[model samples]
Target: VYADNDPIVLVHAQTLLNSSAEGRTAYIRADVNEPDTILRSPGLIETLDLTKPVALSLNALMHFVTDAQDAHGIVRRLMGALPSGSALALSHCTPDFDPQTWQKVTDIYHRAGTPVRFRDKAAVADFFTGLDLIEPGIVVGHRWRPSAEDGGAAGEDGGAAGEDGGAAGEDGPAPSDADVSLWVGVGIKP
Candidate 1:
């Protein structure tokens, strides 16, 4: 199941994302601040099997959730509800790399009445505290699991050997790391 609180994005996603014959694609109007509401939602409960491993992806979302909303706690709660072997894939905006530029962006968000918090690497990494991270832990968005042709991240083994051409940016994707200014990683619950 996919969840998004933004009505506009939800509408767009509904039009674009569809279910396949073998599996179903479900969507829910959910807020990251309300873990309990999302966890208990009928759509999610009905579509997903909580007993088995479920992939929870939070791409480019958590940065909007400030510390007061318990960003990490919300993730822990969501992960806590699922059984072992569940996976978490997250990508968050960070000010660690181009701090001046990101801070200006944060100011813009604030001016628009939308509070934003661009976390540093340490804070972003905290989101995966209890899970075991995969290779190239918590690197910039595009650098994570790049196609073998791109040579992967700085020190990656470049072993996307059998990767089905679907790896992120398969056909020459992304700009510099500082340009992206986001942290991404995938972790599996033991």
Candidate 2:
């Protein structure tokens, strides 16, 4: 099951909801802060088994939630619902590398009425406090298994600079840490 608060996301997700006979897909319009509402969603309950491990992916999402929203608490509550061995795969924007640029970005987001907060490394680490962090711990998004050979962190998506071994400008000179201020990590519930 996929959950997103945006109706537009749900609209886009609708086209991809067609699962093969051997599979299943469900999308719920739910907010991240409201963990209980999301946990009790019919679409989620129908699609996922609470008894089994579930991978909760929150890529490029937490940045939209501000400190006042208790972003870390939301993560804990969501992960708390899953059985042990469940994993949380997350990536968040950070201001550690280029604070001035990120401040401008934050202002832009705020002007547009979207809550935004760029946390430092330690603050981001707090999200995985109770869980066991996987190897590489927290790092720049591209540095996570970055390789030109693997197409990972190689392109605009999240590849290392020039590591993709692609033609000139193919990956666009590799994304700098400041350009892609995203921090990514995975942790398993104990």
Candidate 3:
């Protein structure tokens, strides 16, 4: 299901997905913390077949789901709603490489009323419990499945790739781990 707690985000997502020339698309303005809301949404019901596998993408989101909300339990509940063979593609902000920088960033976000809690790799791996991780499990975002140009190696800090279309920028070298602080992985329900 295509869901986001923010109505504006859902509007944009709906617009973008519905614009696709092929395939059916629907949107759900629901919170991830309430897995049943998303799983039972009429929009999702109309768009997807629960009897079949689904591809769930939780990109750049989990870090916002703080421990107070039981983020791991929320993920498990959501994923459990899907059938076997369902895929989960997730990306999360991490403090494993640069705890100081990420901590400052988290404070900034918290001040803005958007609290964030960066996790270590092992903590993020916990989200995929009961699911089989794909190749290059829980690596830096761009290193999950790099092209030949990325040196076919796992990323370390900002040296591997940047969020800006994988370009390191013209003025500086690749980013440091402190700068590019996100981990990504894909997994499948067995």
Candidate 4:
């Protein structure tokens, strides 16, 4: 399932429909703010199995939600609806290091009809509430379990980058300068 405030749902629905030949597909045009609109819709409730393990992704999207909407609260509500073993994968823009740049980015979004609320590392961690984080807890996107394909300074271990680049721990995969500003993590429900 996918949710977005924009009307691009039709485009994504069409793409999925065109790609899927053996499986069934459905699209619900709704905003994340009003999850009940999709949850309570006819056929949707009966179609998806809430008991099964599901991956809820919030990739580059949560920043659009402001504090008034209770972004973290909304995530908690969605996670609570799913049964145990459900996983949440999220990638959020962080302002932990460069506040000035982040502020400018936020301002740009403000002018473009959408408000961007970039959170720091700790603030982003708060969204995972009661879930168990997988290894390499809360690091830059590219630094999370990097593969050989990612060209960068490799450490003695298979992880990306090295101690000189700021990723120090055994599992710490040093991130490129640009990637050092973003925060990404995955958590599994118990």
Off by over 4 Å in 1: 151-174
User: Tens digits of per-residue lDDT for model 3 on 1-190?
Assistant: 5788898887689668763456788878889888899998999998889999999899998999999999899989989999999998889999887778788888899999997778998989998999999887777765556654654333453324454324453565555545667888899999
- Winner of 2 and 4 under TM-score: 2
lDDT of 1 at 105: 95
Winner by lDDT between candidate 4 and candidate 3: 3
**Tens digit of lDDT per residue, candidate 1, span 1-190?**
8888889989898998788889877788988799988999998988888999999999898999999888999999999998899999999998886889998999999999998888999999999999999887888776666654665433344223223212345555346667778889999999
Error of 3 at 81 (Å): 0.6
Q: Give the alpha carbon lDDT tens digit for every residue of 58-104 in model 2.
A: 99889888889999999999999999999999999999889999999
Q: After superposition, how far is residue 127 of candidate 2 from its true place, in Å?
A: 0.5
In angstroms, give how far residue 168 of model 3 lies from its true place. 8.4
Q: For candidate 1, give the lDDT.
A: 0.82
lDDT against the true structure, per candidate, is 0.82, 0.84, 0.80, 0.75
Worst 10 residues of 3 by lDDT: 151-160
- Full ranking by lDDT: 2, 1, 3, 4
Minimal lDDT window, size 10, model 4: 150-159
Q: Per-prediction RMSD in angstroms? A: 4.7, 4.0, 3.9, 4.6
Clash number by candidate, in order: 0, 7, 5, 0
- C-alpha positional error of residue 102 in candidate 1 after TM-score superposition, expressed in Å: 0.8
